[model samples]
Target: MKTLGKTILLAALAWAASAHAVFAPGEKVIVLNSGDGSISIVDPVSRKEEKRVPVGKEPHHLMATPDNKELIVANASSNDLVFLDPKTGDILRRVPGISDPYQIAYSPDRKWFVSASNRLDRVDIYHGADFRLAKRLPTGKVPSHIAFSADSKLAFVTLQESNEFITIDLGKQEIVWTMPTGKQPAGIWMTPDDRHLLVGITGESHLEIYDWRARRMVKRILTGLGAHNFVARGDGRHVFLSNRMANTISMVDQQTLEVKETFPVPGGPDCMEITRDGKQLWTTSRWIRMVTVVDLETKKVLHQIPVGKSPHGLYFQSHAPRQ
Candidate 1:
């Protein structure tokens, strides 16, 4: 019955649509928080702006429900999360009372959402489907970003104030480990195999590669300048780190833990993600209101489409890569 309902809905959309569009499979439509109080939706295929909706002030990261039916924007200045209809750019609802909310992460099972608050030094875990606050998990000073382990058993949050990563055991709902990193660790990513966790430190241009099983930082890969947020390729073979100061994306070899390529991007590449088929990579320039799309194979900019002001975090839905 659920499948039938989806089919019927797709049929209705097809009947109403004008043309067949190629959507990047597993490629999520990324919304950029243009600090000017607007969210810009980027269509990866067309390399064009799909929609721009007015939002709250200083919107940072965004999270979509497991079903992808809803997208929530973390409005840092407004101290709320604004929920929206992903397909139609409609404001559905808003959850309030968060202090300086920054990055957002979903549980592997997509049951819960944990959003980090910079001013409050806490993470608010929300019921994924309902957007209800389930638990308030406390952390160290200036919690920056959050990443969950592959098994979804643990969550690692980077604390900027103390330069440490706090590991939270999801099952027990407790802090199991705290690993220290360089100054002002900002963004983090768990490898595809779930064996290692990569942390990007802002104060220093370094990538901390931690062996999760070993519970320690075994290797530190040096980046060019201002290594901030990052995303891994679909194949998990390479990781792209957004070097904000250098205005480039540094492709690091996951196996060797070495920088393989340093490609130029727009000013202040804050966060990035790859298409599901791993054909194109997209990054949002923080200083500029544009989304830079890079062709993975040729390593060239295909488009620099305008978005909202001060665009920050990005998200992509998983889909079959273009053949």
Candidate 2:
């Protein structure tokens, strides 16, 4: 009887562990539909759309607060920010008077908040704690994306129409310098060590590596046509880039700056997010109005779930930490 009871207890423990695995039933993946201004809430385990909630007009990008309490979505056309519960996809409140917040992000230190105005050709800096406008810096034409330095003292912005990269000093609230880049630079990402900047040249088909200290192009990594955006794979060594025109995603080595693997993804793969266990990749299919789930190890698309029109940004609470 004693041995039997011990065996039963061990089996119960195993069952509990399996029940609490990541991507369990209550967890969800959020997708932003830019065309229809709706948010699709998906279940990762069941791989189904749970519900759709209407947000503001033209919600392009989103980011969670530093404290992880609220997820803020930037509505460019409406000129407002909608705060939502990160776990439940419920709207908490809406804050207005933000001018064309196309892409928004918080600094590493959580002291500054910056938004790039794609149509207004300006970048707005706000106090991280109170969300008050600190300064409005006039950038070049069409500021599309933003990336900050490690220390949070400087920020880098990509100008899509002007074909330039500009850096702003956060403390002084002024443009420090600007340098020319490839045609139509859209996404900008800083290396982990803050030594190099990777600009996704949407007009061309390559990524330009620029040295920030020296202010010069170090090298160019030839990716698929329309290299658009990047996201780290949670591992310290690898990063992934979405090549929109080529309809492929490239796995790149961070240290060597070489393309390790390239997987064919369809329907204009724009933005991406990885699962917490790092076994799957979720990307927004802009043209197809769907989201594609790819098996990381096998490099095969597992499923494509139809979403609203023009899906762009994707997020989940249980995501792997960005490298």
Candidate 3:
């Protein structure tokens, strides 16, 4: 009887350890449902959604605070930023008067916060410390994605309608230069070395690589069609770009700047986030209203979990750092 008791206790302890190992404590995947104005909280380990939290209207994009304490959801139609507790998935507060904040992010140095107003054709810069409007610079039609230089002195924005990429001087709070790009450029990512700017041409099947220092286009890396967004693997070796129309994800070597491999991801894969361990990728399927999980080892989609309508931005506290 005592031997059996000991065995049972050991089994129970093992079960507890396995449960904790599945997910890091206080970690949950959060995705923005733009079409339905809701947010989905999901368990990465079990691949199950825990709850659906209603947020402001047209919540399209999200970003973590510089301190990593709060997750800010930008509701473009509602003109507000909803702050949520990253661990608890609870609404902390909402700041209003942010006009058409389609996409928002902080500078690398955390000195400035910028929002791209897609519908209004403007870019608003705010003081990062207090979220005060410092400047509202006019941009081309439909400013979509944004990226900051390594030193935080400059910010690059993609004009979807105008098919151009513009640089803004954060210190001067003015436009520095503008250059033409492929049609409907949606995602902009700066390489880790800060040597080049990669603009995903959503209307085309290639990514434009621009030499920012020389102010010229260097080369174009061809991938699947509707090259929408990018996320670094945080391993300092590779980055993943989602091709929405082609329904695939391409892995590119950061150093060689060459396409290493491509994996099929159905349902119009859009935004992406990588796991902390770099074993898996989480991406939102904007057309199918689901989140697809891709296994890096096999380079295949393992499964998908249903979320709300038109899921766009996705994030988790325990994710790999954006390179």
Highest lDDT: give the candidate number.
3
Kindly indicate the candidate among 2 and 3 with the higher lDDT. 3
**1-323 in candidate 1: lDDT tens per residue?**
99999999886676224112335332336565647888776655445677787888888887666667777788988888888776545689988876667788788888767788887888777776666777788889999888887777788899998999998877777788899899889888887677888899888878889997898889998886788887776555877888898787898888878899888887788877676657777788888778787877888887788888788867655532211
lDDT of 3 by residue, 1-323 (tens): 99999999887676446435645786788999999999999876567889999999999999989889999999999999999988667899999988889999899999999999999999999999988999999988999999999999999999999999899999999999998999999899899999988899999999999999899999899998999899999987788999999999999887888889988999999989887778778899999999998878888887799999999999987778788
lDDT of 2 at 181: 95
**TM-score-better candidate, 1 vs 2:** 2
Give TM per candidate: 0.82, 0.93, 0.93
Error of 1 at 223 (Å): 2.2
RMSD of each: 8.7, 5.8, 4.4
lDDT of 2 by residue, 1-323 (tens): 99999999887675345324756557678899999999999876656788989999999999889989899999999999999888878899999988899999998999998999999999999898877999998888999989999999999999999999899999999999998999999889888878889899999988998899899999999888999998889887788999999999988887887889999999999999987788788999999999998889999997899889999999988777888
lDDT against the true structure, per candidate, is: 0.77, 0.89, 0.91
lDDT pick, better of 1 and 2:
2
Off by over 4 Å in 1: 1-30, 42-51, 97-99, 316-323
- Off-target runs (Cα >4 Å) in candidate 2 are 1-20
Worst 10 residues of 1 by lDDT: 18-27
